[model samples]
Target chain A: MNDERLERYARQLLVPGFGEAAQERLGRARVRVVGADAVASAGLVYLVQAGVGRLWIEDAEDVSPSDASGWLFAPSAVGSPRVEAARAVLAPLSRFVSIEPYPKGGVPTATLVFASSGPQALASAEAARRAGIPHVVVEPDAEGGALVVVPPGAPCYACARSTAGAGRPAQPGIAALSALGAAELVLMIANPESTPGRRIDLVRGVATARPTSRLPGCACGGPGAGAT
Target chain B: MSASAPPRVDVRAYACPMTYVKAKIALERLAAGERLEVWLAAGEPVENLPRSAAEDGHRVLAVEPLAGAPGAFRVVLEKGAGAAPEWP
Candidate 1:
């Protein structure tokens, strides 16, 4: 690795098993993010800091006044498209990573879904799974909600999503969930075959994790890779 | 048989954590039982690098002053099995 990259990701390189090889893997990752709203703010920042090679932000919504209350969007950026505004802020965080709006026919090594609604999260995650790549999905609610991790071949996020109806509007605490989700995705990118199918819930600031299983005959339990 | 000189890294210009980080990356590239020679400044680097390497399951073979280089030392390390058990 070069001096610039060494210094940029020095901390994670020190993580056991996160050697030069892992750093190179991270630098080679093309990660698509499904939302750039307040719910995705912290995760976008996390991905940039972790030095994923490319960030393809897939949001189509304008920044809301509430986005400024989150991490990335500037108050003045409200009304601009969220992906552009987010790329504007996240781009300067690390020169090692390339940030842009998602392109048509873009293929990502992994996906991160910080979807504002359940349907969007499900569809984004389903697409990633069908592509046979890793993905993480954040479901934010008023207190805090859940995030599902679907490493390739693991149970589908659709099977892992919360049974409860979409709970409430995203709360500030959703930052914890988003950041945690980003961490999960980073680890999966760094160690592709090691991530498990799981769900982590953050309710009123506490977090709990459990392994996820596929519904009978779910697509994830198809020909090759089966649910854990 | 006379042993070949081990791979070397100079961390004398860096401090604390980075000194260890540089040495660790050098170690990461080598196979288990391969030795690495790290050149670092005497005080903090001398005090920390050997301990850090040992803590990560590396063998601290020697800590000798660099010839004709003031306030710098050479730490020789042998790579250990797998990675540190501490981090999973």
Candidate 2:
């Protein structure tokens, strides 16, 4: 680590069990962040500030007027590609992190999915599970949101997510959930053994988490599971 | 056991957390039972470092003023064998 990096990450390095080794893991991580919107802006900024080495943004939507209310986009950036606009803002936050659009065949060490819909989250999380990449999925509802963290051998997102939650109008409070989601990913990346698979629900200002269990017949438990 | 010459870090130029941060990193590089010497500015850095290191399970061997540097102190810490903090 360089002198500047030591200074930049000094606070985190002081965290118990998260020293040079954890920082090295973070510096070597390639993270794929799916979806780019107001809900994802906080996670994107946290990941960059926490020093994830490479970040690939994978959203297909353009920045809409609603996105202007968030931190990553400006009112003038409406109609621009969401991923591009996100990169423009996120790139300047940290010099150590490399921000780019997700490539056609790029392999990510881990993934953070902020899908706009249930089906999208399912598909993205399933792909990450198949690839054996640890991942966290953010599901924001009207009240607050939930985050599903799936380590390599844990229950998959489909088995863990609540069945009834649906998309809601984006609000500023959701940023707290987004930041929590980023912290989950950081813990997963920094200390995989210490972070287990779990589902965390954020309601109002309270947060609750529980271990995730695989549903019967879920592919995550079958032979050749996570084989890709 | 006879005392060995421990690795030293000068953190007088930094402030509160950085002082402890540099000392912690230096301690992380050592094995349990090994000692580290940290030179920090007086006041908060001096007041907090030994307490924080002890809270993190390290042993505060000694804390005293530097021989020639006024308003500077040296802290000696023995690394502990405890595991790092895990997620909830």
Candidate 3:
């Protein structure tokens, strides 16, 4: 690594187990971020700041007025495509990371899904699982949010997600939860063997994590689990 | 006693965290039982680097002032056999 990069990632390098090798892995990662609105802004920032090399933002919707409440989108960007607006804001955060609109057929080494709807989250997480890639899913509620981390060969997100929480209006706490989701993905990418599949629920201010278990008869436990 | 020149890093220009960061990266490049020499400015850098390195499981072999460089010091650290700390 060059001197500038050494300086740029100095703090992360100080983290135990997160030295030059982990930083290099992050620099080589191609991450797909499934949403670009308020809920995903913090995660996108965290990923870029942590030096994820390439980011493909997959959001077809246009930025809405509510998106202005998030840190990444400007009021003027309300009418533009969400991905484009996100790329604009995220590009300036780090020169090491390449932010772009998710292209058709682009393959990501990892994924972070912040889908607005349950169906969207389910589809994206399932696709990532089938591809055998590590992924994190953010399910934000008014109280806080939950994150499902699925490393390759671990339980799928569907099996890990909580069925009790109903989707509610986006609150400020969602940003913290989203950032936590990014941290989970970072750990999964940096130390795959040490990071197991789990679910982390952030309620109010407390965060609780539990190992994810395969629900009975869930396809994730079958012989074809993680099969592409 | 047998002796070998250890890998050296000069982190005098960097501040807290960066000083240890540079030293840690240099240490990571070495194998277990290998030694790293870090040259750092006095005060917090000198005071904190050795402790931080030790906390990360590396052994602090020696910490002393560099010859003719007043207020500057060198730290020798021997890499340990323990695995790097795991992430949550």
Candidate 4:
């Protein structure tokens, strides 16, 4: 990486495990964020700041002042498309990354997909699943946030959504929850550890956590389950 | 009514996606940085629509349900200080 690039990401690169190699992995990776609203505001920003090589943003809405009330976006960016505005924010921060602004509906090829756009993005996420791509779904609540990651060969986001009854579209909420959820998903994706085919539920505020396995014929059908 | 203020549009009767759509139409026709106050009935749009407006770069002043009209909200969406984009 060039001096400028390293300097731009100096803070994150300072992390012990996120040296040059990890940064390269981040740069070489492709990420698609389905919704660009308050819930996803920080997650998208974090990924961009982390130097994810190419970022694809899909949201079919315009920015509003209230949307900027959250920390994720600035008031100056109100009325801009989420992708365009997010790109503008991340551009000067990292030249190594490319941000593609796509209207809602089109699903680009991505190694990982983050669903924060409610249900609309989930349909497109299904397409990614059929293509066998790893995906993570984030739902941030006012109290905290919920993150569901579909590791490679793990149950897809579609199934997870269905299982959680969040398979359909819904409204948006605070940026904190969404950003935290996005961070959790990204960490799981970057490190396999012991979370595969394992479903985890947590209450960030209460510090309560649970891990469970899917039952047979639960519709996920395991990693071999057919992509819908 | 303040002589300086224009009439507002009510979008509370609408739902998600459409809430964003109607707000977009209003914001587009409005002058730069003009305010378009929308009233949205309670539902998914409450969550999705404001976020949509913010995502597209509009300004959302406030979002609170109407009194005794649970789920309905009076939202004030202000056009940005710049020109609005062409509607999709």
Candidate 5:
């Protein structure tokens, strides 16, 4: 690592299990984020600050008025395309990470999903699982939310996600929850074998995490699964 | 095998944490029991680097001033088998 990178990641290197190796893994990762709106704002910010080498933003929505309530989007960012507006803000935060729209055939080493809708989240997580990459899905509900961490092949996100249907009203503390999700994603990207698949639920301010299990007859248990 | 002098890193220009951070990176690149010599500024860098390295399981063999460089000290650390940074 160079002097600038050493200082840039000085604090992370100071961590117990973290060292130059993990930081290098994070710096070399290509992270594909499935959403870029308000719900995905904090995660996107965290990913950039944590120094993922590349951020492939996959959203195709315009910023809504509600987006301003989140962490990254300024009020003026409304009416602009979600991915571009987010890139404008996030790209300035880290020089090492390349932020851009997700190319149609782009392949990422890891994925992060913070969708506004449940179906979008499910599809993105499934795609990442099928690709045999580590992924995290953040679903923010009122006051709190849940984040599904799917590390390679430790029981996929589809089985880990809560059955709560779409449109869970976003409330205060959602951005923090999203940031937590991003942190999980960063850890998985750094050391894919260290973390297991799990669901972390934050409800009414308390948090609980439990290891996930494969659903009966799930395709994830079929041939070619469990890549890691 | 004949023993040679340890690897050296000059962190005199960096402050508290980077002083130790650069030294740790150098230690990580070495095999077990390989020693590292860090040249850092006196006071905070000198005082903290040795303690921090000791706390992380590396053995601190020496902390002494450099002859030519005023207000700078040299620290010698022997890398531990594995780093065990203290936890709360």
Candidate 6:
């Protein structure tokens, strides 16, 4: 990251472990965000702020009144397609970082894909699984924001869905969680030294959440790579 | 069912994936064991209708030619017993 880029992301880069190098890593990375709703909006803003090099957003949805409740979008954006609205928000953040917005929903070429909890988020998760792309699905909690990380190919979003007995396809209160979850996922993908099958979580100021333990024979490369 | 029940979907103007995407949404709203009847134009759905329905764990009860419409077909599908889909 150059001096100009560092100044651009000064707030985030000022954090303890995150600095110019991390911002540089983010700039060199390609990330795919499925769905540009409230949660995705929040998560994407953070990623853009961090200067992720290439952002591929897949959503065929139009901006509705509900999206105005989130940050990064204004009331005037109502009825505009989310891709168009988001491009305007992201353009000012980083000129070096390329933004590729897909009007139709499908997998784009990316190193990491993030799906926030919702119907479309789940659909994005399913598509990523089917395409063999690494992904993370996030859901946030009500109090001070708790994050549940569904890392790619491990205890996947599908596995979490089944385990949680998620009766509704997309559960309620999923938007905030999904966005925060995706932000964390971008962080993980941006860090090159991160080992495979790593699971970590953060509860605002509480503590850093780590996976209970690596799942033995987990296809996330903790053990078995072919276990699905 | 009524003697003159409305068709569940009219897909004359849609293309691939849009057709399938619309069909999937309709299927999601249906109760288990119920059927959705779809009418499509003379293209992809002739084959894609059955393929997409099967992929969703639904049963394609019938796929027959529509009278007076060249290359068009009517597709009827019964929703399968499974967890509700995440997407429509």
Error of 6 at A42 (Å): 1.4
| lDDT, each prediction | 0.87, 0.88, 0.87, 0.60, 0.85, 0.59
Q: Estimate each model's TM-score.
A: 0.92, 0.95, 0.94, 0.56, 0.91, 0.53
Best by DockQ: 3
lDDT of 5 by residue, A1-228 (tens): 788888888887887667788898988899999888787888898999888999999988888888888887898989999999999998888899999999999999999998767778889899998898999999888768889999877788777788875565546688778888999998888788878898998777788999999988888888878742
Please provide, for model 4 over A1-228, each residue's C-alpha lDDT reduced to its tens digit, 9 standing for 90 to 100: 654565566555433233455556667666777777655666777777777777888777776776676546788888888678777776776667788875456444343344544565567556665655556666554445455666555655555553343331223434445555555545544453424633335444443333324445654555575432
Order the candidates by lDDT, highest first — what do you get?
2, 3, 1, 5, 4, 6
- In candidate 1, which residue pairs get closer than 3 Å at backbone N, Cα or C atoms, i.e. clash? none
lDDT of 2 by residue, B1-88 (tens): 3467789999999987888888888887777888899999999999999999999999998999998999999999998877344232
How high is the DockQ of candidate 6?
0.01
Q: What are the clashing pairs of model 5?
A: none
Give native contacts recovered, as a fraction, per prediction. Answer: 0.28, 0.50, 0.58, 0.00, 0.39, 0.00
Give residue A75's lDDT in candidate 6 (0 to 100): 86
Chain A of candidate 2 gets a TM-score of 0.96
- Candidate 6 error regions (>4 Å): A14-21, A103-119, A126-134, A140-153, A162-179, A192-228, B1-88
Q: Could you give the TM-score of chain B for each candidate, in order?
A: 0.88, 0.88, 0.90, 0.77, 0.87, 0.82
Off by over 4 Å in 2: A224-228, B83-88
DockQ of each: 0.38, 0.49, 0.52, 0.01, 0.37, 0.01
The residue-by-residue lDDT of candidate 4 on B1-88, one tens digit each, is 3435754767665554455655665666666567877778777877776776776677888888777777678777777755334322
Q: By summed lDDT, which 10 consecutive residues of candidate 1 chain A come out lowest?
A: A163-172
TM-score-best of 2 and 6: 2
lDDT of 3 by residue, A123-194 (tens): 999999888889999988888978999999888888888786657455788889989999999978887776
Report the C-alpha displacement of residue A184, candidate 4, in angstroms.
3.4
The segments of candidate 3 whose C-alpha lies over 4 angstroms from its true place after superposition are A224-228, B83-88
Report lDDT (Cα) of residue A143, candidate 4.
47
Question: Which sections of candidate 1 miss by over 4 Å?
Answer: A168-170, B1-4, B84-88
